[model samples]
Target: MHGPASSGWLLVALCAVTGAYCLARMRSGAEGQRSAAGGEALMGFGMAAMAVPAAVFTPPSWAWPVYAAVFGAAGVHALWAARAGAHHLHHLVGAAAMVYMSLVMAGSPAHAHGRGGSGVPLLTGALLLYFAGYVLLTGVRLVPVAAVAGGGGPAGWGDRPELARACRLSMGIAMVAMLLTL
Candidate 1:
C-alpha cells in the first residue's frame, strides 16, 4: 500500500503535540479540573487516533464501521452536553462529520475502503467547507485572546485553558489537512 508522505507526518506530529498538551493539562488540581481535562484529553486522543492512521497508512477493513460507531457515540454524548451549553454543539458537528465519512466509506468496495476516504464528492466537499469555516472562525476568535495572553501565551505547564484551545485549533487544522488528502 502507498504510505503517506512528509505532509502527512507533519499533520500526525500536530496531533501528537495536541494529545500531549491535553495529557499535561490533566495534572492541574483546580476544581472541576479532572472532568474538564479528561474530556479534552479524550478529544485530543480521539483526534490523534483518527488523524494519524488516516495520514500515514491504509485503514483496516473494519475501520469505517468502527469510526462510525465511535463518532456516533461521541455525537450522542455531545448532544447531551449541549443541554448545558451551546459550545458543545461544535463537538456535535465534528462527530457528525466523522460518522458521516465513516458510513459513506463503509459502502465502498472492500479494496478501496482502506484508503482513508469516503470517495463521495458531496460529503468530502461539505466536510472541507465545514472545516475551512471552523478553522477560520476559530482563528478569528483567538486573535484578541492570543494578543492579550502576551509573550507567547503562557507556555509550559500553565494556562490550561489557552493550551487546550490551541490543541483544539491544531486538531482542526490537522483534520482539514487529512480531509484534503482524502
Candidate 2:
C-alpha cells in the first residue's frame, strides 16, 4: 500500500466496499456461504486497514503485532476449515500472506512505505506468484459464469455466484498489489 496517495485511497475504497458487501452476504447467505462470507469480510476489512497510506496514519508500534496475531489466528481457522472445501485453503493462504506482511512491516517500519527494502524476499515472491495465478484462474473461471448469469435482472445479493467469484478475484488482485508494496 506504500504507493501514491491516490492508489492507497483506491485500495481503501475497493476493500471497504468489498467488506461491506461481504457483511451483507454473511447475513443473507445460506449456512455454508454465510461462514465463507464472514471470513472474506474479515479479510476485506483487514486489507483496507492495512492498505492505508503510512503518510496519512502510521499505526502505533503495537499495531503490527496485533495484525499478525489476528491474521495468524484466522489462518489457523482457515486451515482447520479447509477440510470442508478448497476455498478455505485460499483463505488460509491469504491469512498467511497478511501475517507475513504484518511482520515485515513491523520489522522495518522505515520501509513501511517502500522506502528502503531490498528486493522482494523469496517468500514474498512465492506469495506473489500464488496470488497472480489465483487471480488469473479465478478470472477465467468467472467468465463463463458471468455470461450465463447476465441479464438475470440481478440475483439476490448473496445468491449470485458470479459476483462472489468476482469479489474473490478483486481481492486476489488487491493482494498482488499489496505484496508489491512489501
Runs of candidate 1 exceeding 4 Å displacement: 1-3, 29-39, 53-56, 108-120, 146-158
Most TM-score-accurate candidate: 2
lDDT of 2 by residue, 17-76 (tens): 988888887865356668799889999999999999887988889999999999999999
Model 2 is weakest, by summed lDDT over 10 consecutive residues, at 146-155
lDDT, residue 86, model 1: 74
- Candidate 1 TM-score, C-alpha based: 0.73
Candidate 1, residue 155: the lDDT equals 40
Task: Write down the TM-score of every candidate.
Answer: 0.73, 0.91
Candidate 1 per-residue C-alpha lDDT over 62-167 given as tens digits, one digit per residue, 9 for 90 to 100: 9878878888888898898878777678778877877765675566543343445456477778888888888888777766664123256544463455556666
Q: For model 1, state the Cα shift of residue 47 in Å.
A: 3.2
Q: What is the lDDT of candidate 1?
A: 0.65
Off by over 4 Å in 2: 111-118, 146-154
lDDT score, candidate 2, position 28: 54
Q: Which 10-residue window in model 1 sums to the lowest lDDT?
A: 147-156
